[model samples]
Target: MTGVLTDGPASTRSPARFVAFGGAAAVLLTVVMVGSLDLHRLTTTAVGLRRTISEYALGPYRWVFDTAVVLLAAGSLAILAVLVRKGITRWASGGSLAFIAWSVGLTLVVVFPKHDWSVGPSMSGSIHRVASLVAFISLPIAALLLARPWLRDAVWGAHARRTFRFGLLSALSFTPILYAVLVNVLVGTSWWRVLPLGYIERLLVLVEVVSVLVVAVWAIAAAQPSYRRSNTSR
Candidate 1:
């Protein structure tokens, strides 16, 4: 199979590839820098703050995460768009872009604010709850779309199968990490909350960080036209 799938000669780059790689790289770097911050101390302090002020202060943090999420979604969409332009997988690529757009809206309006630890029964809270639920349900939908032959084959063939496989795995792994962050760290409503939610959150975050790095590397490698053409030919 390896011999049957030898890559082609190198060629010039596409602007879309550059956009995808640069965006992914920027996201990875931002995540690394943010991960280095003393979130433990920050979260602890925010948790202790009188809920109102904590809510206000968390806005900036939420914005930062929202920005990162937007960049990642854009980068991924750019990759898909490039593939589609090359006649790789029109439907799958389009669906993926739609999913990203939906997810971005949900992340900003719902999931992002939930990290506040201060928002209560307000307009924002309602929007957050609705959006979060939508986001959660959309995850499986996005996963299915991603796994579809058109999208998966295009990406996997163009970028190294191993790289594409890892990207899918990274997306899947987000399920567990998201669960931990939401049920354990964010809510803290159950006896399970008595357990060390902090540790779980951190561990999951580490996984997410690693996943983004893998994606960034894949994006960079996939930018080469030779890589794209080889995979598409197969």
Candidate 2:
């Protein structure tokens, strides 16, 4: 197995890469699992769960999710920053940095505190809808920016195409999930009961899981010196 960051003679994968990858994986997994729980049901359930595990679990969960979001944004930004400094795909790096900043700000200001189980006109219900859209959309944007060269010229061109396709799908999947979360928040209806809501939720979950995993693998591959050298040469 190759190092996570080193490509040719003098490259080494930073521990930060591993941390970022792990955080990304957690973010993806947590979104799927928690997202799958019927929001309306979970909200209603939080009423009771709060008395039991909600309070105990709330702080840790919030911290973990919040930290993961920040880490992901930061990680992506760091990669883009390096690329920009190195004069590789400066435009893409700039755009990725902007998106990462936006994502972090949105999460902190809009989504973090809302994760609380508090009742009465709280935004927690809609937070997932908003955050998921931002998270999924920003990721592919960064991925495209970071992986543009590899995507464009690799002999296995299908890899880049798949990455783009998955990114688009992940971004698009948020629509239904967002709608489902919104409907639950606004109307008190169960998203699962709807004809395709359950299926949509599952599909979104699958897409997120697979997308994150693919990106993690891609990140590792990209960090490889040989991979970078080949793409740059192409």
Candidate 3:
């Protein structure tokens, strides 16, 4: 994998740019995912993000959602590969693992629906929950881990700082809402029906999307000899 992704020893910035652009495209498609759903029927405030995605996966147009996730996962893997090739140091390895874990979680979302968990504690549902947790946790961790190295690298310092801020904000954004959701879950309370989890989760998703784009920009900047030269020269 390393050899294939890092095969080019040329000083050109093509690879990083490609991965960066792909990441941007993936984020855009993810935004479109909301429009693809029947928002009126599925009221955002009540439904969980996982439940919505899972239900969509079972719907007649499941392929649309599934394909988007697959593309996003592919883009993530490509970004990780480039990160490894650059050998940015400081949690890069951990970040790579986090990337893979996130992709796995994405795949599991389609494979295991919400029923296995929401209907009752079934094996499939358990796996779905596990996948969702891993996906949610790993993405932020990867951003954090990668951020330090980017911050330390002189050429990428400013971009790294920005990426770190975006990542930290994204990670922290959902804490209060997540607390509310967990409290509801633990108490088996009916308040969750009105808690607006879907809306909160969507907001978190937006943060995450921004975080990804910010990181992609950092990666592109880091891969170059220097930002100005990469653009001005070959």
Candidate 4:
């Protein structure tokens, strides 16, 4: 039941531990900010559930939205750094690339405001749409791929499974949207209006963020080279 699991050298682990802590804090802050904004919208503006989160970019609180998204990207980058340091994922690996895409997409979403379908599609709006899709889609894939290796580890197996499940949940949250799209196509109705798009999207974002937090916790817990849990006595 006892084994030496190599986390990393002390020097490397120190910096990685710092990065992981900061990353987790930033991500948590993002949740707070977004949640507050949504709460405010519900009480004051009474925005409909079908309205997208990106629509916040068009409001007076645009700066807050931008800052939250930037923080999310920055935090994701920090987690990625820790993952690389711990050898959980490589810089050239598919998981790393997908994570990078997710981070980059978040940044682009902040830079480019949401598309106003009423005003018709424009270049910036198109970019924003694509970026949103990339960010939403990539994070789940990254989580699944990154957590795949440690899924069988004696110590980290439970943590890995939790991360994988969050990823899967986030990915599966899109099914309703897909079904709505297919229905829209067949009936010539608006897909966005067919369901509570905002609520569904919020669920997806929450699950994906939880996945990142789970991975960050794993990285932080496993930062020490001597870190281990034993079930058997020596």
**lDDT values, one for every candidate:** 0.47, 0.49, 0.64, 0.82
Which lDDT value does model 4 have at 136? 88
Q: Is candidate 2 or candidate 4 better by TM-score?
A: 4
- Looking at candidate 2, what is the lDDT of residue 210? 64
Q: Quote each prediction's TM-score.
A: 0.57, 0.52, 0.75, 0.88
Q: Using lDDT as the measure, what is the rank order of every candidate, best first? A: 4, 3, 2, 1
Q: Candidate 3: lDDT over CA atoms?
A: 0.64
* TM-score, candidate number 2: 0.52
Q: Candidate 3 — number of clashing residue pairs?
A: 0
Give the winner by lDDT: 3 or 4.
Answer: 4
Give candidate 4's whole-model lDDT.
0.82
lDDT of 2 at 132: 51
- Predicted structure with the largest TM-score when compared to the true one: 4
Top lDDT hit: 4
lDDT: worst 10-residue window of model 3:
225-234
Model 4, stretches more than 4 Å misplaced?
A: 1-13, 225-234
